[model samples]
Target: MCGRFALFTPVSELTNKVGAVMPEREIHPRYNVAPGTWVASIRQASEDSAPTLEEMWWGFRPSWAKGKGTQPINARVETVATNNYFKSAFAKHRCLVLADGWYEWIKNSSPKQPHYLCRRDREPLYFAAVYAERDDGGLGCAILTEQARGSAADVHDRMPLILDDDSLEHWLAPDLTHKETIHSMVRHIDAGLVEHWSVSTAVNKPSEGQGDELINPL
Candidate 1:
């Protein structure tokens, strides 16, 4: 699961990289983004094919959620299509979660160590996610997860469902609602597209926010 991530790229760079128009909000750089915080995501509107980038709360709360509980931070690809919390969004509210990289903890005999993972060539990546809007106009999204592949499996059992530029259409296409098409679009990202490294455990705390300390090697 993608519990923590980074998005230090500037808004202008992100717009050009994702080929989406940015909103007017004063965007700040974030080197250690955690769940429950607002982050940028790209989604298409029905009237126009151009992608619109907007900020959305990281955790996902289904419209049917009752009382306060842990909103799902990640949705398993294996069960997303059938799970009540994710089915509706999985079928229709697909989105691309923009990020420079993500963090995962590796458990060992000692305390867990945090590792940063990004595209091998240092290019930006977009995680395939599903989102829903509440009546109050708040937005929430769930990062889709699949079985870990390549070197990533050494650190964790699951990884976020990442999409490539070529697969962007299939993922963002609103008309392709068939279950088969959706499942096909949810496959693991190519291993060659990513790189990883160890970083300081300062990111273990959500309030640490963005700083060089978080990415500094211990």
Candidate 2:
């Protein structure tokens, strides 16, 4: 599951990259973004419309789930289409989560090692996700997860559903309705498109914010 990640790209750069207008708030760089925090997401205005960027909470909780428990941070792709928690969002509230990279923990006899995963060329990535709005007008999102591949598999069984530039239009296109078309769009990113390295566990804490020290090798 994509419980933690990073996004250091400036709002201007993110707007240019996604071809979407930015929100009014100033977004600070986050090297240790955790669940329950607000993050950037791109969503279509309506079925068959251009995408627009917005800030949303990282966890998803439908109105019926109020006073239940912790909101889900990740939604399993295998069950998203049929699961009650994700079906509505899957069909109508799809979104793109912008990130420079993400952190995954590798299990070992010792403490789990945190690995930073990003585009091999250091470009930003877009994770396919779904979201819902609360009765109070607050928004929440859940990162989609599928079986990991390539180097990321070494750390965990599942990874965020990432999209390529070519697929961005198709993924964001709201008119597409075939389940097969949607399933086909969900895929592990090319191994060559990403690089991974161990980083200090300082990122285990989200309050650290951005710093050279978080990316430093332990």
Candidate 3:
């Protein structure tokens, strides 16, 4: 699951790569972005609307479920499209979490080791996601995850559903609500292109906050 990530790519580079308008506020490079914080994302309000960069809470819960349980940060791709809790947002509120890379801990490892995962080319990536309005009126989102593949499998049983560029616009199309249509139109980033390496465990603590040192190879 994508519990933590980093988005240090400059706002100008993100706008150029994502083809979304830059937010009025500048985005600071954050190396250890934890849950419960507002994060930059790419979203389309409607078919006719241009995609825009906006901040959204990293945790998600249906309005009715708010304050009822823990906010979920990851939504399994398999059930997200049909789960009553997620179907509505999955249908119309699909979005992309802008990230440079993410950190994952090796399951059950002694002394627990964490690793940094990113594109082999070190280019930015977008995580498939859906958002809903919170009781307080802010948009909160959950990253979609699928069974792990490639090197990510060694770290955990699941990994964020990283979308390929061709699927970005289609993934945001509110009109395409059919699950099959979505499956056929979107594709995950090729597994071979994603790689990971052992990193400092400082990421286990969110208070370590933003620092390139968090991602440095151990």
Candidate 4:
């Protein structure tokens, strides 16, 4: 699961990359964005124009799950297509959780080591996500996860479903309704396209790690 990730790219730059409008308010770069906090997401515009960037809560509390003990931050891709909690969103509320990179912990060793994973070419990483409007008039989202493959499995058993450029538009296609067709469009990052290195353990503490230094390789 993508418990923590970073997005230090400037809003202006993100707008250019996703063809979305910038938020009216300033967005400070966050090197460690965690669950229960606001995060940037890209969704199709209401007017059928370029997608728009939105600030949504990171945890997904289904409209029917009010007052539940713990909201979900990640949904399993294998079950999402049919799970009642996520199937509706999977059918209609698709989105992209924008990130420059994410953190995964290698737990085999004592004092698990943290790793920063991102595109080898350094482009933005777009995590496949689904969102729902809450009863309180706010949007919340959960990232999708699949069994880790290749080198990524060495760090963790699951990883966010990172989308490639070819899949972005298909993932966010607003009116698409054929479940099998949508499932066919899901894409995973080529293992060779990604790279990771050990990062500071300070990332273990969300408050202290939301800075550039947290991403520096150890």
| Deviation from native of the Cα of residue 122 in model 1, angstroms | 0.3
lDDT of 3: 0.89
Query: Roughly what TM-score does model 4 have, to 2 decimal places?
Result: 0.93
| Residue 217 in candidate 4, Cα distance off native in Å | 1.1
lDDT of 2 by residue, 70-152 (tens): 58999998898789878878887788888999999887625667989888888888898888886457889999988887888
In model 4, residue pairs whose N, Cα or C atoms come closer than 3 Å (at least 3 residues apart or on different chains), thus clashing, are none
Q: What order do candidates take by lDDT, descending?
A: 3, 4, 2, 1
How well is each residue in 1-218 modelled by candidate 4, as lDDT tens digits?
89999998776775675577776888889998999999999888444777888998998876677757357999999998798888888888888898999999998765778999888899888899999887677999999999987777878989999987778888888877678998887677787887889988889889775769998989
TM-score of each model, in listed order:
0.90, 0.90, 0.96, 0.93
List residue ranges in candidate 1 displaced over 4 A.
47-49, 66-70, 185-188
Cα lDDT of model 1 by residue, 14-44, tens digit:
6675478878886787888888888888887
Q: Which segments of candidate 4 are over 4 A away from where they belong?
A: 45-49
Model 2 scores worst on lDDT over the 10 consecutive residues at 170-179
Pairwise lDDT winner, candidates 1 and 3: 3
**lDDT of candidate 2 at residue 209, scale 0 to 100:** 54
Instruction: Report the poorest 10 consecutive residues by lDDT, candidate 3.
Output: 11-20
Tens digits of per-residue lDDT for model 3, 73-106: 9999999999888999998899999899999998
